[model samples]
Target: MRNGFKIISFFIDPGAIQPFVQNAGFQSGLLQTIVDDRWSETNRDVYAFWPRLSTLYNLNNNQPSTWWLRNGSFLRLKQVDLGYTLPNLKKVAIKSSRLYFSATNLFVISKFKMWDVEMGGNGLGYPVQSIYSLGLQVNL
Candidate 1:
């Protein structure tokens, strides 16, 4: 079962043009409505598959509907941390030392490909950032 919600306004809604660059090959359900030789009388069930691109453009200007809703479920590798403690370093005048590494926003797995699903309907918003960090600690 699907959970969560995403309004795909930024991607599919022609009325809401995006300010940033968009992939030329980005395929949405709207693409399925582009009529071609593949369409025939038997495929009359296909609603609004217009023979002309202009007709499709006009249809897209309508208000949002259930067709624009998509499952927002996602799995994300939010963060990871690793650390190692060094043995006593009396010879070097240092009593102890340790090293550590950390990372955040590593990656995300989701069907909503337009942007981070957590961003929700705001596709124009900046996506979550990935961060990596390394550190050391010493005690004299």
Candidate 2:
């Protein structure tokens, strides 16, 4: 694995006709290989497997979609949930009431991409942004 900023190669040739070493690979996840002063971008996800999940959402893949999930690149904000309801209902033969909040794909993991590749729509492939929910229960 390449450490620090300098290049770590297999000692074949640094300025030869073929810059790529024959059997050079990474050692572990702790080290990274930086090539040509450029880092590997989120390519795996942008080019992930587009399969048939359903008729509307992850169906044929080329169809119109509301969201797209990038694969094998980096960490991405993935769900969100928030809820609230009336209280003290369960005590009297009624459903209980409570309040809660949550978020999915809450924020983004990478700053390189402003928008997520997994997300797509007929529009311009906007992002999932944030989702919020509210609910209520009553005793009858």
Candidate 3:
């Protein structure tokens, strides 16, 4: 965060991007999503790793390559937990008790690029959220 303004980056450059597809790389179970003849047009190759592969293109061959923006992010706080179980109170009419115990989304952690504040998967402008809980319980 810079001056309270979130810093984000994107890819927006289109140039000759050609990756030759192995003619013999055909698989039996899963088909490759991307393949090239090594002599295709020019554009920045986008590898979002999700949904599908994307690329920018010009309407005419004489025009320059088009570009788009892609962003990968870093880890953000997912959850926090702090709790305390009540002491032995079963001697009287009361039974088990608890205090100041809370739990949030403490399982999923974001695994994206270096500027992502999202959890789990990388989305757009997903600010990392923190869950704070307070409560009291008693069993009788």
Candidate 4:
């Protein structure tokens, strides 16, 4: 018999390197078209030029640029599980049992906004969700 009390066990899975396309941030291609009501043309500077809506609407003659690509790299916390095993319940006809709580897709720290970073195509997809669960396991 292993003469020791099983205290705590933890499992963590940090998922893969996900490269995605994000378009909701300030680095969007339609920056001038999506500004808020407080936006002003006078706010334009030498470095940040605000294009008129008509100018942007007539941009079929312009060439595409890579200036609107938001960095979509992040380390995601995929899942975390914490569990505790109870001592053997010999009299109850139960050998051992464990209770555990787990969570998935908990959080993401990214520069992108209003969208999930795992879609990876043109940034048009459903967002990811966080899930939580609790369970028990027994060995008889």
Number of backbone collisions per candidate, in order?
0, 11, 5, 0
User: In candidate 1, how many Å is residue 135 off?
Assistant: 1.5
Please tell me which model should have the higher lDDT, number 1 or number 4: 4
Number of the candidate with higher lDDT, 1 or 3: 1
Name the candidate that leads on lDDT: 4
Estimated TM-score for each candidate: 0.58, 0.31, 0.32, 0.63
List of clashing residue pairs for candidate 4: none
**Residue 94 Cα positional deviation in candidate 4, in Å, after optimal superposition:** 1.3
Number of the top TM-score candidate: 4
Model 3: worst 10 consecutive residues (lDDT sum):
21-30
Please rank every candidate by lDDT, starting with the best.
Answer: 4, 1, 3, 2
lDDT by residue (1-140, candidate 3, tens digit) is 33222222222222322222221122211234224412233533443222222344424322322222233333323444444566678678787766653444433332322222232222233545546577777789
Q: lDDT score, residue 81, model 3?
A: 42
C-alpha displacement of 113 in model 3, angstroms?
A: 12
lDDT for each residue of candidate 2 in 1-140, tens digit (9 for 90 to 100): 12211221121111211112111112111112222222124333432323222225433444444323322134544454445454456557775554555545555444223234344222244446666544443445
Q: After superposition, how far is residue 71 of candidate 4 from its true place, in Å?
A: 1.6
Q: For model 1, what is the error of residue 100's alpha carbon versus the real structure, in angstroms, after optimal superposition?
A: 0.7
Clashing pairs in 1: none
List candidate 4 segments past 4 Å from native.
1-33, 37-39, 45-51, 54-56, 60-62
Q: Report the Cα lDDT for residue 137, model 4.
A: 92
What does candidate 1's lDDT look like per residue over 1-140, in tens digits? 11221111111222222222121112323343244412346555444323223433545423345434445566676777666777678999998777777778777766555456565444655667889888888898
lDDT score for residue 105 of model 1: 71
| Clashes by residue pair, model 3 | 11-70, 73-113, 73-116, 74-115, 74-116
In model 4, what is the error at residue 15, expressed in angstroms? 12
